[model samples]
Target: MSAPPAPLSELPLASRQDGSHPRPQLIRSTWADLDGTWSFRHDDADTGLAAGWCAGLPAAQEIIVPFPPESVASGIAEPGFHRVVWYARTVSADDVATAGRSEHAPVVLLHFGAVDYRARVWIDGRFVGEHEGGHTPFTFDVTALVADGADHVLVVRAEDDPHDLTQPRGKQDWHEDAHAIWYRRTTGIWQTVWLEAVPATSIAHLRWLPAGPAAVDLSVRLRGRPAAGARLRVALRFDERDEDLGTIDVDVPATATSVDVTVPIARQRNGQAEDELTWSPERPRLVDATVSLLDADGGVTDAVSSYLGVRTVGVARGAFLLNGRPYDVRSVLNQGFWPDSHLAAPSRGALRREVELIKDLGFTACRIHQKIEDPRFLYWSDRLGLLLWGETPGAYEFSATAVQRLTREWMDAVDRDASHPSLVTWVPFNESWGIQHVADDPAQQAYSRALTDLTRALDPTRPVVSNDGWEQQNSDIITVHDYEGDGAVLARTYADEAARDRLLSGMGPAGRRILVDGAEDRGQPVMLTEFGGIAFQPGTRRADGWGYTAATDAEDWIARITALYDAVRASTFLAGSCYTQLTDTMQETNGLLTAGREPKAPIEQIRKAVRGRP
Candidate 1:
């Protein structure tokens, strides 16, 4: 056919780069996105390493960067599995225009948003570094090699075993065909790859936590060698109403790489204004801040821009609390897949619109099912005001290798996303998919609990769900999954105190124990985390699609969904409820919207159902 349409990554800018800062958590002015056309090939035989293809790939076709070769958007939608792949691209002078080349030994980092499985990289044919884990980002400092001031070619080789059951491949069917809950695979480089130049000394990572009613705490980590008499300055503002909520300056110790400081904000005189200063789905007030690293002479050496929302999350009196208020949570299970892009988003605007669409449908939170989302999505969630339940993709098999892979990757995901104010909960496991025997297996139960405790150690600010839906080894929130189609049956099952007590004790929903650790009630909040999968597509059947339950017509679909919401709301037991899903995937058609994100019913009806209102 004719030439395919230009990919989004290659298109020129008007409202470009998805309309948000790349790497929103920490942003410096000196950076550029390496997200365009690239030379590509599938090394199915795995001869690239021995053949020395890392130095260069002589014969390769063109494909779009950031879009996996499995996707149509990549211009190389190969259906068959390829265990190995290689990509090559030249770094243009324009790409490095902002990376100040004059500084003596300035640090320049090549940041990969994400690469599936394991990725090995080379700069100008010289080996640089490699990173494992498919979801979280990794950066390599190429300053030493690229400092020669010449052309540089980035060649990447990625290895992913389609048959590896122990790998944390979430919802990716190993077989050639997509079936059941599993969808397509994203083999390599499914996110943006870019570069940033920073001063020798800089701020590496940090997080802002709501310390109390009137203060927020900061844990800042510095990179490189600390200078004597050096200092760090931070300034905070809200809505630009106050230029400086607090201006903090602390002297940096010569040997210290990290520092913690508490910034106290002036309490608002008006109660409503004070509430507005806090972040929520209704009123998303963001606190903007600037971080500056000063040299011994007090001259700014490295400066970056960042922001956070002031909020706290907890479980108290058997209810989920946000900002100390018993806020009811309405969540949707988001697979974050696209017809054109699979696991990767179609565009940056799509990421923003995804958040707006969830809000439009009246969801307070989104359980990002089985995948670590792009940081751009988290940035929009923080900006547009939506809560998130961060969940990791599970491995199908239980083994030491599986546990080790899932645990390390999950922790890295937690560390990358813990700074986002919108992330309210950490779900390390789901449905006990990896540790399937956790309910009766002592070893599995201990591993699950240990993982939960480890997540807490990483970020104590958010609640940890040891294993969601069923067979939970440890959890701060008791969640259960039930797909009972009838609203009347669903209501009666969770009608009164006795039914609630029964569920907390031994009886389970979906025929799986809610708590498998054999412990008494810890007085945790109970939620209908998964329910109501009413599948209804308006047109003819395609792709042999199906759902947990099917609806007849649009009106019937809306009514059935509404009745379930009403039942959940009427129950005296549940603090919150999450529906089965937001959009229909390949073979699973039980979605309020289609895979392309088109609403099956009217937006108003869906929003009303989600809100539990007429």
Candidate 2:
């Protein structure tokens, strides 16, 4: 197979030796990034484990960490599929010591941003842990395994079978070549891998739920068991200032692993009016906070910095509400694929740039299509105030294994991203890829309902879309996809009261029912989640690049897109619309920007089109 194309553009933060911490919400002062080059080899026979390769692999070539082997940025641009791959790196004593080593001994945690399909880790020839999901952060505590003042070898085995329909592969092309909507396959590590040092009794996870304009609910989960007299202290402050909003102290029972505490926010603090601190796209407001575990003697055992946005999302009266007001969601579909990096962004700046560019184009939200995006992307969205729909990458065929794999991965993704305030919805399925018989088969329908229920159970604060585009089962919102190129037809189909009623009552676009049997709309908010895939390739059409309707020229492309937006706006039923993408990917040229993120039309014009303004 030919190697993927090299990156057309480089961000300032893109480097082989990136040392930045991966997770921004939960910040630890002492951590080391292990994102540089690492010893790597493909284990085709899967005999590396028997050969004692975990201790050290002989004749292993160097490959860049974080970037997948399929991508050009990984240095080893071997695009062929290998079910298993091995990666090894050495961590020095100093690397662990820099993380606030104490006489009591610190807990060293090895974190992987993501590893495709499944991953197993070993430190100093001792097995640590394994993770199944490919799009969520997983960690292994190796404090007991690695001795201080010594060099330790870290070995990882990542196994993936993209062609296996049982696995949740998302947009990773299962075939040998990219076809239809699927692109190049991403195998092994595709995100940041790093190490963090923390106190033995540190805060493991946090969930920030904005109660209202006046209060925020904070949930804390502890990593290790604390002492009998240990207490959790939380202090909240505005990100823009050092003034304290409020503070809460919660006593934890020795057996308690988690605590939920509500902290009140004063409208006026220190003679300053702070009532306008609500988070929104116009003015993104973040409240910085610190969680500390204090012992009986008032000695701080552990502290971590985190930020939260005070915003609530709800759907009511056929409208999506943000902060209890009707908020129109102007969004674009982001597939989260780069021409060079595949599923991985070249840098954190690249992720920020993507969000910034989308926001600059007058979009209020991004529907991260199929792929569960990097946490850094969600971080930028939370910091910059862009609404997000956290979507699950779909599996093609339904099976017991597919259900298990998707359930495990979907829950992991929801848990990992539910803390972000910008995440407005959890989409577990898209267009019925895995459960193709969802509309007719009772088993598929039950599975769909189960996924929706699971998502709600995991994150009740956000809406759950069981199947985003069509073949809807039980969903909080009624969403559909239609690529009717004509604006008048779209308006007639979705805008006209009589036509819309018929569509909602029976079949929607593509002769699929808008609601499943025994399911009622119940005034749920409606969104045109996917539409307007106007393709514009400036020059020659590459073999793998195409779109729904090819634009004759730039002006024609702009006119078509603007018209589609106009139709969407004219539709009184649509609470929101997601334009068919942010950027082009292999075999898909229907993006406003090319695969390299070059604008096809004027930014202002695109903004006008997106915002439904002439």
Candidate 3:
């Protein structure tokens, strides 16, 4: 295996040996981070299982948990493709017990932030669980095998096939060398790992649906069957204040695993009418919540802390509405990659920095292209008040396996992120990647429609776009991508009623029709989802880097960018626009910022051009 290259820059957050807690929602004080170093081995011949490596690997190299072997942060730094990889770590019984696990809370859950493609986990030589998705969190209960005052070996085996189009690889490069837009591949665990101790009958998942400014429907899914007379107690409070807004208790049936509780915000409190607070880009308000499962004796069996924002998103009259008002979405396409970390952020601070940078650049929204971003980033987006278009990574080929993988992973992504108020829309496919023949193929069209319908069924509060960009199937928004550099040409192309009618009625740019046959415009909101891939290399362009349009100098870059913005802003029919990218990636130098996150153009100029304000 080739050694991994040295990282160009190391963020301070990367120095922490124990990775931070991965889950921000439903947080518990009783948990231990299982990050640091672990025993590692490469299974080239896939003989690890036969060799009984899960029991204990002999003479194995040490690797940093959560960091993939392909990353420099991983001590092994093995860049070559290893079809099978084995990792082993030992956790002390004291550490597990310290998490407040007892006869009442006897369950010890092992959580993996994410493992690439396929993962099989073993606790003390017994197979506990297996997960197939690469981008969502999974957990296994190991209380039955683990004993107090003893150490237990935890082993994991991960397998990833880059060339397998059946798997959703996202932007991870398939070939040996990074080419075009695809970059380095992530093989093993690339996120945080931790152990959480909880009561056997604890809350497993939380879903908060804010129906109105003063109403929210909260659903709690329990880990175990409810006992007789058991009830879920919920209390709501403002994060900034100590006063409790309200409290409610819902009786959970013994046969039910989940129960919904309706919470209505009080209009008056403390002898005063409560101020109407809604979450928006300018002012974000989050309501802190304390959820507890109380036994018949009024004893708390389990408890967790969570938060939610009161907001609503909808589409009406060809415009996106936020809190019942037409909101203009000025966005930039963000791939959410780091120079050192491929998919994982260097640290929590790095994720915060990315959100701050986007807000400072005057963009209200970020279209996270081709990847389900880390939950921490979504947390930051919710806290920092930035709109997000949650997008799924593209699958290149079409097949039954492709449909299964994309549908399964995409649904998981949506379910995982459905609670965040920052997420405004769900995009299942981009530019007809896996469903390329949707314009002609009935099966493909039906598949696209199925995904759209499924997304809506899962999250009806948010809009669903079956396929973003050209040749739209049934979608809530009519979006297109055009990189016409000349301002006059762009202005003329999407000019007035006649021009729009001609373009929408017939062929669009590059002789591609905007709407597929049998699909009529349903007066859905229109937005240019992609445009202005202006590459502005400070000095000379690198031989490997390329963009749709190149600028000779800073002055030329500013003029071209301003012209494109002018055209987008002048179009009365369009509701929003998203620039090609936020930062440059490997071989794609069309970002306003470099790959290292340094600004390539003047911030003020770019902001004015994008937001049409100084």
Candidate 4:
């Protein structure tokens, strides 16, 4: 079936229109990215030439607004220049004009959907703001730096040295070479760039939290002078029903970061009064919240609205649980890679299609494997009611500085995506990657523990997998990746077969026992985390292009993967399982769909195999 065209706002800013498709609701509304041609430079200039970088900039390159430079969709396939690049664009207050607005709006904001590594933004050639971390969005109020209603020149400098540094580069490598598991380095203006007009003395941002049982804790921060009697009024709403939960008032001082307020269930209504709306794959409920800053006189100054779903996810007694119930995570390991778009998908519809495909196959959840997914993907998962296990990208080595940087990236990623109901798990490190000398590495263990603690502290609603596939260092879930693909062995251990068989036939172990003696454990709740990588080549295709495997046809791919699935179904102990991947990547042919977004095996075969039915 042909895919539906993506929504306008989800497209590159250049393609979005004022009145095109049906207006999609934007949770955290920000007006940015509607402007003139952006200037591009593949390399950064020295301080001597930095001043003239935006002035007399190069001609229009016709690159798409939001796609990354390395992506084919971005119209720039310069893979060689992946480390340092600069982008400059200009926007006027009129560029972001509202329906009925006067010329008095004070602060004009500049926003970046995301930028890799470190980035410094300059407005009208004056330094405005700098941000670290690439995966999460950041914004700067550049109003005072530019003229009131005139065109403002914006310049951005982004530098990414992936593998060589302590920064959280994920699967990105400094070398221009793409090797096993690592793809091309995507650098510079990967996400969207936009602008917004707001009052100079307004609410900067809101940090909304779900504090259990119809209670939401909000911390609102305002720009300009907070010490001079600035305050904020917060309100919660159930979007599906359009019902308001009243509002709360809080005072803020100038030197303070943000003002806090608690919205209670007794006084306010959150979505449907279904007794604490806990979200799950079967029942996903999201609470719409609007936060507004009011002047001391109680007049609205600035407002921003977002959504949050109340749910509790954790690992208890060797099984993953949701809302205090044992919930087996039947999932697929999603790589989030496309043949054409590399890290980013061609369109939001493409992302939605992936989620739909998973749902059609009768799986309840998915483990978004390594790389962080685009926000729209999570949005669909929440709306379509699919559980998600979010994980930090695995790296080759783990250093103290690297762990610190990873922690920051993790915090930003989870913070930005915490509102989505689909997400239920946060995995800090993946199977021995970046981990060396696990036996005596106190620092490594401590770092892993710290990240787990930090993640819990940030959003205590979800479970945290401290280390997936390795040492059982106090992780919430004892996750094990068994690639053996033997049904009898799994069933025996999982079914509590016998001690003799567990030692002799290599079977029969049960209930959270660690078998560190083997290469990887095969026990209760045994998840086939990295199995069924049977590659099948579609005729005339270059199966050798990608390196994971090279089986020569659809029949072979189905045969091997189906056999593995059959074995897994026979195991009584296996509570959950995840196929190696959902789709084929650049060099990984084990995907159900080819890197070109073509289905390799028959759809019927995939549906039956994944659902564990004949």
Candidate maximizing lDDT? 1
List the RMSD of every prediction in angstroms. Answer: 5.8, 6.7, 6.8, 6.9
Who wins the TM-score comparison? 1
Error of 2 at 147 (Å): 2.4
Q: Write the per-residue lDDT of candidate 4 for residues 362-440, one digit (tens) a residue.
A: 6788888767777777777776679888888655667867776778888888876775668877887776556554435
lDDT of 2 at 179: 88
How does model 4 score by TM-score? Answer: 0.82
TM-score of each: 0.95, 0.94, 0.93, 0.82
Ranking under TM-score, best-scoring first?
1, 2, 3, 4
Q: In candidate 1, which residue pairs clash?
A: none
lDDT string for model 3 (503-543, tens) is 77787675567888578877788888999998778887565
Comparing candidate 2 with candidate 4, which one achieves the higher TM-score? 2
Candidate 1: worst-modelled 10 consecutive residues by lDDT: 1-10
lDDT of 4: 0.62
| Per-residue alpha-carbon lDDT of candidate 1 for residues 243-352, written as tens digits (9 for 90 to 100) | 55878898889998998898777764345657868888887777877777777776677666678888889998889999889989999999999989999899989999
Per-residue lDDT tens digits for candidate 2, residues 367-451, read 9988888888887887777999988988888999889888988888887777788899889998888988888999999999999
> lDDT of each prediction vs. the true structure?
0.83, 0.82, 0.81, 0.62
